[model samples]
Target: MDNISRRGLLTGVGALLAAGSLGVSTASARSLALPASKRFKMSATTNEFFRHKPLWGPRVMQSFAFDTPNNRLFAGQLRSETPENSGDLTLSQLDFSGNVLGHMYLTGFGHAVSIGAEAVGSTSYIWTETDADTTNGRGRQITRFPWQNGKTLTSASVTKWKPVSGASVYTPAVDQRFGRLGVRHARSDGMYINVYSLAAARTGDFSTVLASFKQPALTAGIDFQGWALYGSYCYFWEGEAYPGEPDETKATSKLWCYDINAGVLVDSFLTLAGKSLTYREPEGMAVYGSTDGTARLYFGFASGEPGDRRANLFYRNTLV
Candidate 1:
């Protein structure tokens, strides 16, 4: 292996060793074998935010259907400020090399909520959004836009915005179907998975799927956000707040994965192996394909022993 691959393998091994030292148990420690091309290279845009003012930071990202064919990546930027004051939500296009190519601003929406993209036709894509206001408790509707040319996109036409009944509005991730949208609400009890038909966007029709297992009782100050879908599974990392107690029994962190279709927990992996890594706050995850066709998941943690600002990425072989 070359220097880069060697470094990556060593990092993975180190992480496992650290976990072991901390008494973290789950998967056996093994060096990650990464394809040379699949090794992650830090981008110039690696910082928390782009060139924009206030630097709200880039939170979540999803791809447009035409991205692979056209060599483009469409992602939404979640602004750190509130929507009423900031009125910021940005949609950007990036090249395969992680260079920003094109971008547009979204107005009226409080914060650019969650983003989902689907192929409506041969070369057409439908992008959807959901706001992040909890007080309203009403989920916004879906908006459709066509991504065309290298740096041009058609105007967004609002198609659906409806209040979700009998459910508190929360940030949601969506998977599109031909006639409906499968939305999973990350809730305390577990993921509240719901399927909303496209035609019923204004009505917010939903079929709920509850977590197969009981929700763990977490200590106060431990923020438990729901899981994020990567491939066919959803991964969730639960961590404690800052100034966190070091007592592992009182405050601990873990990563769990559940099969999407089966709604069952396949496995739970502890982020801290043997206490080598003390997690402060963990948030957001993404998956990308390595050059050799292997897939890896990247997670971002807010704070830890390394530092609150330090962000670490981890990869595991795709089970699917």
Candidate 2:
């Protein structure tokens, strides 16, 4: 544990910190057991249009999606969170008031992390890439950019990443709801639910919607990070890698709920414990709406312990 004690335990848990606009509590927000201490008032006001000054520092932001008609918010930053940094895919674009409209650098690719975008038809916008380096064979590709001049609508193609039939293993996670482009792969052993067919304009075809299940028991860790698609169900999180046993118990975690249209697997939330405590790795997942809009399922755990500085936003509040 060197690197200055793992960056002083990721700067005492605030690893790459940023928060400033908190008021999270609308009473029973939507129920999934919402009482973890209800209090969400955070404000440092650093949304400087999605700030990015680190040329080489806190870069572990594996996945992020939200490009509602250019209102922007498309992140996939990685340089070190291992998985060989998955080819260091660094694509950025932020604007829903968080401005930073451009940022790109995609090399041959390795940890292209998981990303899935949609807007296919009235103009076109399809982005998909999931290869959290399950040693690399976990390569499931999908690329078609052109929301408005981003170009390569179907020239930067890639679609050979397969594994989705009766089931066996098709690891893919990082869903963004209704705008559509969901994924959570694994079968022949457990956990499965694939959705990606931007009207089938063609791009590594995927539309199994749901498969293999008998009860919440899907486990295949490391790269199936936070996934969400409330309402019909599809909330995911799984992690397992105790290899050398130090990097936070080699990373151990779990949280599942899939019914994305009745695919099955009601609930399972064994976050982390009794094996050497470790829950600091459950990347990006957000759901909060209810003024009558209804939406709950806030997740973003990433703690390295030591000094615990904040980054454990877990909330279920109803998805049953």
TM-score of each: 0.50, 0.27
Candidate 2, residue 161: the lDDT equals: 49
Whole-model Cα lDDT of every candidate shown, in order: 0.37, 0.39
Count clashing residue pairs in model 1.
Answer: 11
Q: Write model 2 residue lDDT over 191-280, tens digit each, in one string.
A: 334555334424544533322222133442134454555334555554533322235434446565544333344455555332332434
Clashes of 2: 22
Candidate 1 lDDT by residue in tens digits, 86-167: 3245565555433556666554333333344444444535344444233432234435556543342222334444323433
Worst 10 residues of 2 by lDDT: 1-10
> What are the RMSDs of all candidates, in order?
12.8, 19.1
